[model samples]
Target: MQKRRRFKQTKTLGQRLAEEVTRLRDQARALPPGRSREMLLRKARQDETAIQIESWLRSPGLRAPT
Candidate 1:
């Protein structure tokens, strides 16, 4: 009998941030308008902004000139 090996894959920072944003937005939608809802929406926005920034930072043109 041969042993089988499994490999685990890890999400990049951008992917993780995007998933978090999606979760926050879903939670906010389910809640009634109030402080908690507002907070969750705000956090989702922040995560979206972070994702944009991360994409910008990773863009090819921004790399230091070699």
Candidate 2:
């Protein structure tokens, strides 16, 4: 049997994702308009969406099915 390695994260998932989105946007801004730039922007958008989803999931207003 193999043991799974586990480690604690110092920051919440939202914080990490927000950081990545900021980094991606900065990188994209430095690049000229082209496929590569578009890709970076797309990735940033994806990360932003993930952040939104995570917040939604953690919201106290959300309720599971009865």
Candidate 3:
């Protein structure tokens, strides 16, 4: 049997990115040593950037992503 996912609207890009980051981290962990370093670091940076942007988007007058 397969499980179904609920279709709730996401409030911010960070929420989406968080899910992606989680997946990336899992993949990074499974990667062979030589291939993991840069990929993991890049994903971490993207996650951090998403967090900052998402927080910024919550500001009273902040602009949405294009």
Provide TM-scores for the models. 0.77, 0.85, 0.57
Output the TM-score of candidate 1. 0.77
lDDT, candidate 2, 1-66, per-residue tens = 999999999999999999999999999999999999999999999999899889889989887524
Lowest lDDT sum, 10 consecutive residues, model 3, at 8-17
Q: Write the per-residue lDDT of candidate 3 for residues 1-66, one digit (tens) a residue.
A: 999988877555777777788878777777777656667869877897878876877878887765
Please give the lDDT score for candidate 3.
Answer: 0.77
Q: Who wins the lDDT comparison?
A: 2
Clashes of each: 0, 0, 0
The C-alpha stretches of model 1 lying farther than 4 A from their native spots are: 1-9, 63-66
What CA RMSD would you report for each candidate?
6.3, 3.6, 6.4
Please rank every candidate by TM-score, starting with the best. Answer: 2, 1, 3
Which is superior by lDDT, 1 or 3? 1
